[model samples]
Target: MYLDINGEQFRILKAESQGAWLVSCDAPGPPRFVDQRELDAYPRAPAPEPCTAEQGEAPQTAAEQARMALIQPLLDNGDCVSDPAIRRQLAAEAAQEHGTTSRRVLRLYYQYIATGAVMKHKPRKRRPPEYENYYKRAIQTFYYSAKRPSLRDTYDLMLHQFFTAPDGHLADKRPTWPAFRHYFYDQAYHRRSERTIARDGLTNYQRTARPLTGSAMTWKDHIGAYQMDATTADIYLVSRLDRTKVVGRPYVYLAVDTATQLIAGLYVGYEAGEEAVMACLANAAMDKVEYCRGYGIDIDAADWPSKGLPSEVITDQGRDFLGGRMKELCLRYGVTCEALPPFRPDRKGLVEKMFDLMQGRYKPILRGRGVIEADAQERWAVDYRAQASLDLTQFTQILIHCILYLNGRRVLDSLQMSPEMLEQGVAPTAAGLWQYYAAAGKSALLELNPQEVYYMSLPRKT
Candidate 1:
């Protein structure tokens, strides 16, 4: 019987019990199921002789006939596992691979077991061809285009071209925003350039295309190596001597142990000079019990025993570190002042990454008062220096608290353990690790004349 569907005539091969007809369209393709109600309005062709199944004239070969015989019994056994629980597990795996329900698999197994016949059916294609085509063409176009807008922008462009009429109105067939996003993002958005998507997207490309990973700097024991660098803190501060005076953002110099990620020592300074670097090194090499007491923190000497000269300190080739007096001081203490090549911060990634993490942690606490970018401060009408509440001494205490927290609690991402954990086999805090190492003679500490090391490190008149 013939009926009209979607403005085309189709032949109804059979009618299902559920009021759907197995119909074949005029297009050269497999037959499809059509609802009976849709074709009810169309006139049907005259009733013809009932269709009958035709018997095969050609006999199947022994090999071909034997194939189904083997398959039927194998499928009857349901994945060949005799145990009931194991059989179900196997059936579930097969069902997932075949994109069907486990219950459907069990039903097929039971049918084969009873009738000795295996059911073969075509699997439905869940993915739409339009989505595939649109994503492929859109990604290729955007990736090769000079003006690589963001992935979101490229999706918008895809929508505009595929779902908009020439008259600037929505077309009849259009994908929803969520569907469009899923389709586009699944097409590997990282292939685009930062010029198109910006910094966050550029990072993906860096991760994929750039060979940034290098050999890790490791040590045999604590204090075997250390990293020292200086950066201007994000928060502006009042002077230690005078609270009314607005000292610009202080340059923070930090010395950190590479093996344990412990903050050995630090110096927060207002002026840009060699004195801060010298002070930082002195702080790192000398005992910190008196230092903490000076700041009114009351830290026990055992809690922060990471003192004495390290075998080496890794730093950049800055003038403060490259001075003749600096070299003399390092040699005097039998410590190597290894200067990394220019721009190779990756050699000291531990300290660099710590700097970033530290800044992020402080951002929330110092909101509306901390070191915002100059442009952001102006745009947001934020007077960071004027709003600053922490004096140099108070800021130092806060920094100490931050360092202690990191050593004690912050899990190191690469190691999947805290610095304190590696420092002491089971130390719960960085200080605990330090104390354990100090008592066990595992700390690579070299006793030095602090007074001599300090004076030698002092910048001499050029």
Candidate 2:
């Protein structure tokens, strides 16, 4: 007999004298004990034809046992019987000799030989939920259509709604507490219920739910795709023109290669508008050999060969990123500017994660008024602006140093190697990847007039 509990099917392994049936289910873990009354709800299947295997035969593999069971009777008695009573007697004797239940022995000897295949049980059709249509609608509206509410509170509210029905009648029936809990907390509405909370709802779904079934777009080469993003620096800075005058937090824009987690270009300044993005792109496109020399850092042109426009640039839906000017600039450079959906940082996670790593590295070192604590104002009780000593030039030098170290030394968890190592396959630094890609005939980098692309990327007054 099959045991059907809440649309699940289980096979009866043995019947206990205490009115309980030991059943085995397909679900993970061990067998369970089910009451006899619950077991009686399911219908019994028809018995299979009897097998002629010897009663004292040793246990064997499914195929071996099946072969023995099928031809043993012909070998012993020259014929098989069609009598059910005789089959039951044979099954009982076989069970005792094999030290197993009679039902299992009969099932294997009859079903396994007849089918000639392994059988896996299929679940039965599920019955409808206890709640009516209107109640379901109400639950959906409260739980999914709005901020997440406590399951207990939802249950209490549902009970109240039932008692205060418009027709002045209470709900006819209520489900058991276990049943209600299972439906809401352990089934379809299980862990997904937390996604309805209002705190950064779109970001929460993008970060948690979307990633489970989503994939990152792949690129054929190193410079094939570049991800750009902007974030406010946690630490405060002072003006480069005047060291005594303190500037507010600056916006840092970064462009990272998608194939390798290499930072191609970066810009740090007071404004986070389209102009900053333009500056960042220009930095990425133009040779940084001269730019680095200006800071007394001597570098050959081959040391940082990451210059040249990428085939595609992906950025989030910021005002600067979504503007038509960005697309026009990409058109001029033979590139594509793709804006990701609003509030989705995962699409541009390469750049966003870099910003987080930068913050973690820099914030602790430059502790003063620049600390990112909520009670920073109260705890320090000092003017952060006055305490800020790192001028823009000094900060820029420090940032460049950090980037160089990251490109050369930092190992990545995802790749099990540094970005530089993965990019070059042999290079010890990101510059090696740059040189190798530049040498390859299939480079996706485009030659462009920086002055022209910069002008086009700037928003025009309509």
Q: Which candidate has the top score in lDDT? A: 1
- Predicted candidate 2, C-alpha RMSD: 13.2
lDDT of 2 at 116: 27
Off by over 4 Å in 1: 1-222, 240-242, 361-363, 368-380, 416-425, 435-442, 457-459
RMSD vs true structure, all candidates: 12.5, 13.2
lDDT accuracy of residue 76 in candidate 2: 45
In candidate 1, which residue pairs get closer than 3 Å at backbone N, Cα or C atoms, i.e. clash?
A: 148-196, 234-371
Per-prediction TM-score, please?
Answer: 0.56, 0.58
**Model 1 TM-score relative to the real fold:** 0.56
Query: Compared with the true structure, what per-residue lDDT tens digits does model 1 show for residues 89-185?
Result: 7668766665766676655544333222333234754668877788778767764465646767877888887878889998777666677677656
Looking at candidate 1, the ten consecutive residues that score lowest on lDDT are 48-57
- The prediction achieving the highest TM-score against the true structure is 2
Q: For model 1, state the Cα shift of residue 193 in Å.
A: 12
Q: Per-residue alpha-carbon lDDT of model 2 for 332-402, expressed as tens digits?
A: 66788888887778778778888887777777787874555455559557556667767766777777777
